[model samples]
Target: MIKILIVDDDIGICKILQDFFEFKGYETCIASKGKEALDLAKKEKPHLVFLDIGLPDISGMEVLREIKKSDPTVKVIMITAYDEEERIKEAEKNGASDYVVKPFSLEYLNEITLRKVYKQLFEDLRTEHQELTNTYGQIVFTLARTLEEKDPYTKGHSERVSQYSLDIANELGLSENEKTIVSHAALLHNIGNMSLDDDILNKKHEFTNEEKEVVKKHCIVGYEILQILDNFQEHALIIRHHHERIDGNGYPDNKKGEEIPFLSRILTIADAYDAMTSKRPYREKISSPIEAVNELIKNKGIQFEPELVNAFINVLAKKQIIIKENIQ
Candidate 1:
């Protein structure tokens, strides 16, 4: 049986969840305060967590963070009052597996707990991945073209990155919004690369300190270009920070982990994977598909959202999407 932990400040809510989930064949653990909830969760190690946003001892987000930190595999569903859209989004961003608006019917709750939450999470992850891609695509073409005139040797690099981005985005079952932003980000990830001297771009040799510095600035350059466009404002962070290192060693600004927006992180996985797998102007080696995915998984949380890395894996396993060459 599935083990579920219900954490709500209200005794009534705890009773409600216990009865409902137990009736559905789940073993249930109940806690009426956030502190107790955290203690119970640490002890019980439930398969799923149903958490209320309002708690007596600590805020729900605080509890959620602690729970995930304790055991990153447990899926947490935030239970919030109907008017808490801001809280809900915060929960989503803060590693929440799903959220349920309060005053929901027990039957609906049961169904969501058993079936709907994972689907929602998968869809949302995919959507964000796509949106980031599309946002990057809008700016990279010009940068790639600029580089092409001077380097000639790396004519299709950005375009190929765009293609690889699309493939991975679809493989992840990314939502329409995610595919859109990321496609654009992939295309423009090299905006800074365009400004490097032709000798450096087409050098076919290890980059000098100065050349590498010039190449690393594309992330910031892309961010600057898109930061001003209408609707582009939404994806500016992604463009500016995609190249950031997981260990805070990557170029431009060294923002690490969650400090980097999800869009930028998503693009980093797609861009880095493509760069490793596809032939590049200066590098010609290609990793096997399995090898590429393993590399992405190895970098999760440090460089990508752990959930996204898992979802990307599942999407590939399920093969649940189709990709068309043209975005129209």
Candidate 2:
């Protein structure tokens, strides 16, 4: 049977909701105070909680926090009077699953309850999806680390790129989701290098035109490999375009300007900065940090998005986030 907890200080309101939910085939519990609500939540462990924002013993927000802390998966639907937008927001941030203002119609409450019940019914599938996502992320990380182990010169390059990309993304005020895409794409940017010959990756001398052509194929190779995983389809596209130049002079497809993915633009600058500062098979010596920054400025609009270069410089100057030497 489905269990629902209704927490309200008003005895009349609690009785009304209890009768309504119980009539709808739910086993209902009620609490008229914050402490009582928390204790009931711990003991009953209901699948759903309709929590009020105001309680006599402690604030409803505190009770919501305690309930969530104990069981994050519990669906907490907050109850609030009108003109409590701030409190509603607080409840949401504290992990309330939904909110219903006072004096709501029974029909509306039923709709909300039905939605919650549906979620509860499919909760196992959601858990499995989350597990798969986590497992996939671990696999990507292991692949990146293995790629690095293949070439000592580029060791730790992906980590530095990911860090730099995150700093730049934060500076640009990108959304959390965008930052996540940038982070993962940067970490596995060179995953295609895993397919390259060891001599190509580790050569101490400059590559011939033919060798350079072969070397650049890692971008496409990485994209193909990453895209094979469902979780990495979008990220694979970013990785593929990371090597493309802003002027459309880059490899494979030669996509240029705004044609490149936005996060890819951010990843490009980070990748270049790290590559310059790091020792590469083609470079005689690692460029100094100052030199790398200058290169980014010089190549702006040619190799990277001009705005991203400016923001990246600002991130470096303002945040004091250091890029360790020999990253790329």
Candidate 3:
């Protein structure tokens, strides 16, 4: 039987979704919080997810990343209260298959769930969703590349961040599951950048307070962006918390210290290293590896994790993978 996982904070909604999906001859599971949903997604491995865009603990976007990382093929359809602009843009950028707004008709949503997930559920000879996971992921990846290419400073930034995060993950002795989750997070962590204007992104002048707020919004934007993606739940923390600092000075949420997910903290290190080592549209690059490492260390316990900072320093020293402001 096809299985559907419903992640939502409203107890009433959870019960409604559960009863509805069960009536449709499908097995269903429910979790009221984002973290619980993630845990259930792993244990249940549901074929599809009816995910809400908001949650009590973490936002639905973070949960979406985690879900997608665990199983790329998991069909996810976002259920939101209304079509909020940033959230919608974020969902599309993060590769959501489709969405349904709240106060929705159960009959209509049921039809949608079946039409999209039936192929993944059945081995029908005429099924079109037989390879839905891999197929949809490629299409999203192409879109992700396109989004990044719009900004030279960030072109291939996702790829490099993924690589660096993978390297750090290996050194930290992460479990296979954790490593995969981290890798996926690195690739799509900046998907929220799609909501940002090019003019704001490439400005040579310093940002006004308003512009700075916009810049700081990318993390939350990313969190909202991936809320509808089937496979992006586990990775959402990485995207949302990567900008968070050890001292709790980061944007969107000022999550402090270990309050941030470990993967996100690790990703932050990788992201900063890459940004420092690359050229931006407005600023000259910092081209010295030793200086970059020093800068990271100098700010540790403030901007970075002390242990992760030390571990990364060792990696750079041993591999001569010095952090600089420019590459090539």
Candidate 4:
């Protein structure tokens, strides 16, 4: 679980924040004084801190300096009643992740906290890399689940696609590094849909041409969002082009066979299969796993890479494949 430290002299404020953060599924520690905050921060090594600008024992700004000096990576978000520009600048200069003024909205604080958690996860990924991929993998999947929750029909799609993609990667004898990248791409493939309109995303009917065009833009949006982060730069391209087809009939960019990235070609099959077998709002009945594989073989060299289709089928033939019940 992501840990948080809350530092405020007011007992009511501390209790309220503790309740809210705990309800949000975060592990939280609270300190009423700046000196106590430093001691807790050093002992617990919390990933993030919400530091009050004024504290009973010591100045919060001074405590912030000490915390950063002790652990530069620990992110601090200043909480202040004063909104003076100078204090804000000083906080920024001292490396505060963000700030919230007194009497702020609980919703705003929730948003800020979630954003910082993801940022902290990314930082951990950079420092630990492969050793911590499993831990970070769950974090990323949780983000993907947040997207899936917006549309009921797609609840487990990301996990299924991720597993299928990983199996395909193994079939191709990919390196551990390459497989990990593929898994991340698979997990986040549809994250761009988060920016889409809910009506179109969960419509019980086919999309009109304009709505379809809007839907296609998610690839570009997801790519833009992921490419900004250094850790996901390489996987960004695969996510952007996962919908591209080999026959030059795909969207965003009309890249044909060999023109499309290889990993993306592999992802295409995995993504399509899960979507085929999973229930969607527009389609009441999902195709069975066997039927979905047949569709893949039928569409070989057109919607997917012919060689990969054959490989995926061969791999599945050797294993007993059982898809979860389709969500209604």
Candidate 5:
């Protein structure tokens, strides 16, 4: 479970925040003094801290500096009554993750907390890449789960897409190495969504053209983030082109036809099928598996490669994963 440290001199504010966060399923520790806050931070090693600028003992700014110096990974959100620009700058300089003034809304605070926590978790995952081996799939699944936790609408989306992609790879008789690459790439296809704002991600209304452009940037972002890993260079390139169309009408780049990577084509079919059938915030309801498959067939040779789409449909049929009556 995630732990939070609340450091404020106001007894009432501490009580309210502690109760609110605890109710939200976080383990919280409270401290009214800078010395106590530092001690708790050192002992508990909390993932997040809500600190007041006006501590009775040491300056909260000093505590922030001390905590960050000890462990730069610990996120600190500074709370202050004054909205002075100088103080805000200083807190940021000392590694504060965010600043909240008095009279802040708990809902807004929770939103900030969630964003910081997720951002930190992604960073940690990236660091863990260096230690990866045969356990790579487990680590990738953990990363996907963490991403889904942040966006409830896409829960199980990555895993399903990965499975679909693997099925296609197997149907095409891909080598074991190729299948591994396809599986990991599918699982991490949306890893870039981690950088998107919660508002844009969870918007219930249709996205504006600008929002669509912003959303399209995820492909590049995911590629850039994954390319740095030792053996993920190919995965990065495949992810970068997963949105490209067979006829040249897709994504960050407009690579057309056979120019698009083969694994990426497989991922495109799997991803589009899952998106069509999955519940989205803007959609009234999800399409049936048959409807999704028909859509894939309709778009084949245009949005997706014709042969891969046929192979994918056969894979679904053979696995009995779709409704029998729906297969035509």
Candidate 6:
């Protein structure tokens, strides 16, 4: 289990954060003063720390400095008020991983904490192993499952996408290495959604233009998270462009047609098919498999590559044990 240290003079805030983190399966320790926090930092050796900018006994900045000097490996996140921009900057200079402002949402805190912790963990694993292994794949799937837990509508979504993507890869006679890339990319493509706020993710109404733009950042964020790993660079790039369209209209970079990576195009079709057939918060009803296939057919050559769409439909037919006779 992950261990966390919460240092704040505010008893209520400490209690609240302690309860929340504990409930989320993290072992937590709370300190009401800067000195106590430092002591805990030495004794507990926590994986992460949430240190407030203000403490009763000593300056939170001093405590931060002390913690970094004593154990530079521990990740510290400064907890600050909205106006302490300079202090936040200084804390960053002093080796704080990140900072969260006061009046923060628990959901947002959880998201950032998980991102940082996992990022650090992945980096550590990379240094030790120096190559991809079953452990790495399990960690990737764990991230996917963690996102699904936050949004019930997406339960099993990544697994289905992986299966579909693999099917498409095989249908197209991709090399074994290419199939492995497709599988890993499919599993982790939506891992960026973990960074999105729960409000936007669970909203029952269609997103506004601004909200859509915010959501699109997930692709870039996903890429950043995975690109740090040594051999996962291709998977990271594939995840980043999975949202791109065959036309020149896709987001982030808007690479068009053959400019977009071919594997990303395969993932695009698989992701879209599963999303269409699954229930979503904004959609009133789910699209039947046939309806979803027809939608893919309709969008082919525009949103998706025409040949990949046809191949995906065939993959679906084999699984559903039916022909595509109804899917013009």
Which candidate achieves the best lDDT against the true structure? Answer: 5
lDDT of 1 by residue, 25-122 (tens): 78999998889999899888987899998887799999999998998767899988876778888998888887788788888876656576657546
- lDDT of residue 154 for candidate 6: 81
lDDT tens digits, residue span 1-328, model 2? 8799999999889999999989999999999999889899999999889888888889988998999899887888888887577777888799888888878898898986568756765885688787887787788789889989877788889999999999999998989988898998999998888887888888888888998899889889988877767778878999999889999999778999999999888988999888888887657546677678877878888988999998888887676544534223
Off by over 4 Å in 2: 1-137, 282-284, 319-328
Candidates 4 and 6: which is better by TM-score? 6
Of 1 and 3, the candidate ahead on TM-score is: 3
> What residue runs in model 3 are displaced by over 4 Å at the alpha carbon?
1-136, 322-328
What TM-score, over all chains together, does every model reach?
Answer: 0.48, 0.57, 0.58, 0.57, 0.58, 0.59
Colliding pairs, model 5: none
Q: RMSDs, each prediction?
A: 20.2, 12.5, 19.6, 16.1, 18.1, 17.7
- Residue by residue across 1-328, what tens digits does model 4's lDDT show? 7799999999789989999989999899999998899999999999889999999889999999999999888889899997878998999899788888998888988876557657776976677765565565466567678989877899888888888888988998999998899888988998889888889889999899999999999888878767766578878899999999899899789788999988899899999988888888998646887888878878888889998987787667656673323211
- Give one clash count per candidate, in the order shown: 38, 0, 20, 0, 0, 0
Per lDDT, what order, best first?
5, 6, 2, 4, 3, 1
Can you give the lDDT of residue 98 in candidate 5? Answer: 88
lDDT of each structure? 0.74, 0.85, 0.80, 0.85, 0.89, 0.88
Per-residue lDDT of candidate 6, residues 216-295 (tens digit):
99999999888877677899999999989998799789999999999999999999988988888988546878888898
Task: Kindly indicate the candidate among 4 and 5 with the higher lDDT.
Answer: 5
What 10-residue stretch in candidate 1 is worst by lDDT? 319-328
lDDT of 3 at 7: 84
